[model samples]
Target: MTPLLELRGLGVRYKGAVAPALEGVDLDLAAGERLAIIGESGSGKSTLARAVAELLPQTVIQQGTVAWPGLDQKARNGRDIGFVFQDPASSLDPVMPVGDQVAEVAHANLDMDWRAARRLAVELLDRVRLPEPALLAQAYPHQLSGGQKQRVAIAAAIVARPRLLIADEATSALDTIVQAEIMALISALVAEDGMALLFVSHDIALAANLADRVAVFRHGRLVEQAATAELVSQPRTDYSRALLAAHLGLHA
Candidate 1:
């Protein structure tokens, strides 16, 4: 079977930057497979996500081929890519009711009428296990907690059932309990839909729980990639060892 996402010699650099945020990175994500990218801040993890989604900013220069099944080469927005941003509150509009914001995506992409679109939004919210989907549908971002907002984000991302979902540090802003909840929710959704997942996070333990394979990044370079069990037990690079040690120290 063809891969769901493929990146070859991927590199990104913003205009007038001293160095590229990412360089010479290659990755493949198969349908129903989970891949986690772990690295320190500014290690190009998020950059890789944006590049895959074709959402990089105007000032950035990209050199690579990102092929997705059924992607509209003419209109990049129609591609089968969904994104769950790190900060839920920032990703949502303060004024619009969360449901309406989510419904808009379905309306725009799926061409559903307003009523049907709204119903789909509510259903998605409920699917994410939000309490009182109808009531929450009427609420704004400020009315929801951080965890609830993240749920709403997840709901919106999967509303269209995209083939590939890219979550960039999605659980980092939530409390530990909520983080666990969100991770479980994400995992369940991936299993439910069988969509490919590209998860980017600095939390090794959390990522390990959800990923089949782990790819370690260092200074924008992909230094190591392996199965989660193998990589955790025997990291090939010094950087991977340091990252694993840091995570171990936190719990030790």
Candidate 2:
């Protein structure tokens, strides 16, 4: 089967930066597969996500192509690739009701009418396990908890049912328990919808638990890519080994 999404020799450099944020990064995400890009701060994981989503800042110079099979190449926006940003509150508009914001995506992408779009939004909120989807739909970004806000953001992303979902530290802000629930929700959604997931996080343990394959980045380069079990049990590079050791120590 053709890959749902592919990134080839991808590179991104911001103006005035001494080095590129990402360099020669290659990734292929098959339908229904979960791939994790894991590394510490400044490892270029988020940069890769932004590049794939075509959400990078204008100051950044990007190279290479992000191709999605069965999707129009011209429609490179949030509608094409769903992005659950790291900060859910900031990703949402403060003035707009959560339902309307979510409905907008459905409206824009699917040409859904207001009434139909709102119903779809509510359904999506329910799909993400948000309690009282109707009530939550009426709430503003400030009215929701961090986890709730994140759920709302995810609901909006999936409203259009995009083929690829790029989550940039989507669970990092939540408490451990909430993180687990959110991760489980993400896993369920991807499996149920057969959507390709690219999860970017600094937490290797979380990545290992959530991703089918883990790709490790160091200084803008992907140093290793392997099955989660293989990468955790038999890391190839010294850097990867050290990262694993650190993760183990943290858990210990």
Candidate 3:
């Protein structure tokens, strides 16, 4: 089957940046497959995610292709792709009621009326395991905890039921316990909906635990890509080994 997403010799450079954020990077994610993009800050993993979602700023000079052979029509941002940002605070509207924020996606992308969209939004809030879906729906971002805000963000993301979910460091801002909960929620939702997952993270351990495959990136380039077990057990590059070592040391 055609891959859900494909990138070939992709390069992205900011208008006046000294170097490209991403260069000559080629990668693929299959439908319903979970793939992690592993890298530290400025390694360009997030750039790759934005490029896939076409969320990059217009000032950036982009080269090469981001194609979806699996999609018959042009892929849309909210309808074909669901993105959960690292910081839910910035991603969500502080003034809008959380429920309507989610309902808006369904209203816009899925073309549902307000009543149905809101009803579906409540169901989604429940699906994401939020407390008191009906009551909490009226709350604003400031009213929710970090974990709860993240859960609301997740509800908004999947409300339209996009085929691909690009979680750009989605769990990074939460505490360890909350991070695990979010990860479990993401994993369960992906499995249930069969949505392709692009889990971008700096944590190799989290990647190993959640991804079927891991693609290691460094200095804006893809260093290596392999099955999760293979990459974890026998990393081909020194950088990969160092990352694994760091994770081991952290847990040790």
Each model's C-alpha lDDT? 0.87, 0.87, 0.93
Residue 191 in model 1: lDDT: 91
lDDT: worst 10-residue window of model 3: 243-252
lDDT of residue 40 for candidate 1: 96
lDDT of 1 by residue, 39-151 (tens): 99999999998888778998898887777644444323423677999999899999999999889989988989999999999999999999999999999999999999999
- Could you tell me which residue pairs clash in candidate 2? none
Clashes of 3: 0
Using TM-score as the yardstick, the better of models 2 and 3 is: 3
Worst 10 residues of 1 by lDDT: 70-79
For model 2, the stretches where C-alpha displacement exceeds 4 angstroms are 69-75, 250-252
| Regions of candidate 3 where Cα sits further than 4 Å from its true position | 250-252
| Model 1, runs deviating above 4 Å | 69-79, 250-252
Estimate the TM-score for candidate 3. Answer: 0.98
Per residue, candidate 3 scores C-alpha lDDT tens digits across 141-252 of 9999999999999998887678999999999999999999999999999999999999999999999999999999999999999999999888999999888988756221
Residue pairs with colliding backbones in model 1 are none
